[model samples]
Target: MSDLRDAALVSKAWPFEEARRVLKRYQKQPPEKGYVLFQTGYGPSGLPHIGTFGEVARTTMVRRAFELMSDIPTKLICFSDDMDGFRKVPTNVPMQEELAQDLNLPLTKVRDPFGTHAGFAQHNNARLCEFLDSFGFEYEFASSTEYYTSGKFDEMLLKACWEYQKIMDIMLPTLGAERRATYSPFLPISPKTGHVLQVPMLEVNAANGTVVYQEPDGEKVEIPVTGGNVKMQWKPDWAMRWAALDVDYEMSGKDLIDSVTQGGKICRALGKRPPESLTYELFNDELGQKISKSKGNGLSMEEWLTYAAPESLQYFMYLKPKTAKRLYFDVIPKAVDEYHQQLRAYPGQDLKAKLNNPVYHLHGSDMPASDMVVPFSMLLNLASASSAEAKETMWGFINKYAPDATPESHPNLDAAAGFAVRYFNDFVKPNKVFRAPTDQEHAALADLALALSSEEAALAAIAKKNAAMGNEDDLPVADFADDDFLQSVVFAIGKNHGFEPLRDWFKAIYEVLLGASQGPRFGGFIALYGVKETVALIQAGLNNELTK
Candidate 1:
């Protein structure tokens, strides 16, 4: 294990790189807090999105990496800033009028539109926990409401009262003249109207742990900063949380790079060092716009799981996190196949190599074998070619391609097969356009079809001959299900027909036969879908039967 840790110290995997950053924080002395704390903050203004899950998932990867490299105990906190003021009612939720009436109140004070939870933020917090729980993430859930109301934040709140000017000096320069004029570190919860007042401070009584603010009716009110009477503005609150909790590590999106910096300075102002941090690039929608939780334009956790397994979503979150990537339905198939590809490769990887493999970071030492005898992309192609409406239809081809596999024995593949059919019907089926093959393409496809027909006939003839000679048990029959052989045959036909770049042949086959511009390798498709079935498909394409 020590040797593996030595290798992990220099492993190029992003998780290891991040874990190294956290590990380096304590080279001089271990944390006085006894355990390293990792936190991911969530704003419960809206329902939890894929972005929220990404933060926790990515943080867990780094936490797992740190576990491998250090003997120190680690803790992950998924903190919800539910005490944030409910500035505006989200358009995505129900009971908009009720939410509108609760403006300026802390989120935990707003009514849950869904009528399920105690408050709006509570509803979202429950959802966030449920989402994280489904992924089997090990983390403690914390609420800003509880922290503030329960007096967990009292010590930090009082400290901020004393360092009020210093923290303001750090925050004021970053805001506009107008915002700075009205800004105060402490937003006192209004006792009269139940709103979190964002007014300028009239006075700070640090010795008494209280702040005085002018109410809208021109009355001055002094409230203790402790016991939920006040909440710090976001920037100061972020730093205060770190300082109070002695957080060792946390991460946020690149958009918060400035926030991280501002928070760090404020933490220093409060006489505590900021935790080690990583800034990951944000996810964008299919249109390349940044995904927003309120706009509801991006894929949700539920939607992604509908089309693929949760592990595939984890794989998507795991890859190139520093680089921005599109999060949409179209990207799911690739992530699913690539995740399985890594799973299949994990057993062959040595300790050093395994440290870099994503599956290792995802599942740790309990990584499961890849049961996907068929790739996800190939399954989609099968679904398209078969016009499959059900997993059973796709399984018919799967059963023939891998005789030993079944839905019961290979659950991942079975799940993927079901996902493929749903994906095909929803996405692939709608946009598919079959084009008439060009003359050259038509000739090559015809020849390939003829070749497949001949191969099938030859196999049948050999079977008949053996059966007649009573040599069926003695004679070895030629294998018609050879994937490489079928692939080579298609290649030869394409080359013989003078398709300049032979890839054009395959492309044409896809466009003409499958109503797609790109598809799985034709031979593998044939091996899976069967030679005679592929021949029928080709014949249909040649007759323009499919275009109808």
Candidate 2:
């Protein structure tokens, strides 16, 4: 196993080497005692997808690197730019889909289906925050709405309008020709009309203190916008954010090639060096195009968490360089399985002696082993079928089976509780989505149920079965890994309860009741779902099978 920090270095190409170096660069040293702030920003257009985290998580990596590079602690900040008037609605926005018919009006005036978040900005911004929290990151989150009203970027805003535009003219041609045309040399807003001056975008001269509004197919009119100024347009916003936030590093996707290139101009204009940036790849769902929410296709980070472990995500983040393109969810399950293998193999390997090599970071930190946990889909099935399963209830079960299970204090237990509630409410899929069971699967499950008649019996059965499964030996799967643990879990539930050892019986319990067999311990999960429904699922499924 290579060091985790050295994970992405496969090529000798300049860009690849530079990225690897940037990834390994020192920010922790003394002359720069200031905390390394790795920043992530998103335009509050709509619900942010996994790609959003793709950037933030990379920022986390840089922060993690800084922590490792020296004694200096690094901080990660995710900025949500909610103040920017909606650019053409994101392809993910549902309401904006219809509103594009209105020619990309201000999102404020448009009706958004997703409530709780105010306007397009608020709606999407809320989703991003919720997603970020899911990753268990510790960071200060700031919204542009707050920053704008709070006047944090006031100076940068002023500079963008005053100085950013001048830099854009110089930088735009370098990015491409179309950019030079679409971008206004300066932000044109009317203090009087309080509307963006679009047609004659250049009419209002904040310099001349003049407001010019031109109606479509109408003569140029003048309107005044006094208080409505944020100054610089798009690139300026990027520049000002970099300087104001003191961001030493930020990660943007390849999609922002132009904006990032232009952002450099704005930074130079602000008389500051642009923060270090890495242009990572964009992700498309299984269909292989960019993930789009409005298209009803994007697998949100919420969805990813439902199916994959956080460490799986962390590993997948660097499985390829940020410059490469196209990642799919289908790849995660296997990677997660392999990640478990590496985690188990890392501790005993020569990696410990290789610490001086600087690649020790690629392998994860030392930890006790666990079993290969099942996919999120399976868990959803198990959880959905059995309603009583408390998350900690399952956690408690794992403690009984696995040796290293130390319970968190009561406060952290609250997190598991919340996770259970949401897990059952939103994420669990219906029985219809299940890939039909195979004869071998059915037989193995029944055999597993029989083995579960008692803990010792179940363990023995798993040990026997381990001879056949890939790398399923005594080695623990991962942090949450526990294949044998799960086997005992389901068996225990069936033998103790009336759930029985039959295929139809367990299937019903798993389908309508538990979202997966390979999930939280059946006993604890059953307690959360309750005895009646758990029993009912077993009884009803058998009845349904008999009738069919």
- Most accurate candidate by TM-score: 1
Give the range of the ten consecutive residues with the poorest summed lDDT in model 1. Answer: 457-466
For model 2, how does the per-residue alpha-carbon lDDT over 47-69 read when each residue is reduced to its tens digit? 67667777776666555545543
Model 2 ranges off by over 4 Å: 1-33, 87-111, 161-165, 171-182, 189-228, 293-296, 323-329, 350-369, 373-548
The weakest ten consecutive residues by lDDT in model 2 span 355-364
lDDT of 1 by residue, 363-410 (tens): 988989999988999999999989999999999999899999988999
Off by over 4 Å in 1: 456-479
lDDT for every model?
Answer: 0.89, 0.53
